[model samples]
Target: MATRTIIVPEGMEFIRDELGYAPAVRVEQRLYIAGQIGRGSDRQLVADKEAQFTQVFENLRQVLEAAGAGFEHLVEVTSYLTDMRDLPLYMQVRDRYMAGCYPAWTAIGAASLCGAPGYFLEVKAIAELD
Candidate 1:
């Protein structure tokens, strides 16, 4: 049986403490990262669309790093956006962090995310670790 290990990076303890969920989980060579938003260290949501998209990727990066992984390790990624019109901006910001690493991606238009307005994006991913 593969043992499951919860991943909560150095600065993400509040996720488990307050949200009652692990930011990421590792089972054998696979890591499942939870949905990450555009919130910063203080958990305040970023207001600008472009900046929020960047922050969303940064949040995902933090979870990947916690599992000793990176964008290259990502095998699949699912992005939820409140507005489909923001797809171009999302892709642009995503490209900046993804660079040459290409993973299976799916972007969905969502009515709302995180159960609130102003919260525009949420990203979740699965990674394969060596």
Candidate 2:
């Protein structure tokens, strides 16, 4: 049986302690990352669209790094947005972090996220580890 390991990067314990969920889980060579939002380490959400998208990616990066992986290892990604109009900016910010490593991506329009109105974006991903 493949061992399941919960990944929680340093300084991100709030995800498990408060949120009651692991940021990512690793089973063998596959890592499944939970939806990351624009919240900072202090648990405050970034309000600006561009900045929020960046923060969300940063959070994902932390999770990936904790699993000894990077954006290049991502095989699939799913993004949730409160407004479909924000797609362009989201793609732009995402590309900045993803560089040229394009992964299978799906974007979905959401009415709300994190049980709040200001939370505009969330991202989840799957990665293949070395």
lDDT of 1 at 31: 97
Q: Which ten residues in a row have the lowest lDDT in candidate 1?
A: 61-70
lDDT by residue (tens digit), candidate 1, 14-82? 999989999999999999999999998888999998888999999899888888889999999999999
Q: Which stretches of candidate 2 lie over 4 Å from their true place?
A: none
> Candidate 2 lDDT, tens digit per residue, 1-130?
8899999999899889988999999999999999999998888889888999999999999999999999999999999999999999998999999989989999999999989889989999999999
Global CA lDDT of candidate 2, please? Answer: 0.94
State, as a TM-score between 0 and 1, how close model 2 is to the true structure. Answer: 0.97
Per-model TM-score versus the true fold: 0.97, 0.97
Error of 2 at 15 (Å): 1.2
lDDT for each candidate structure: 0.92, 0.94
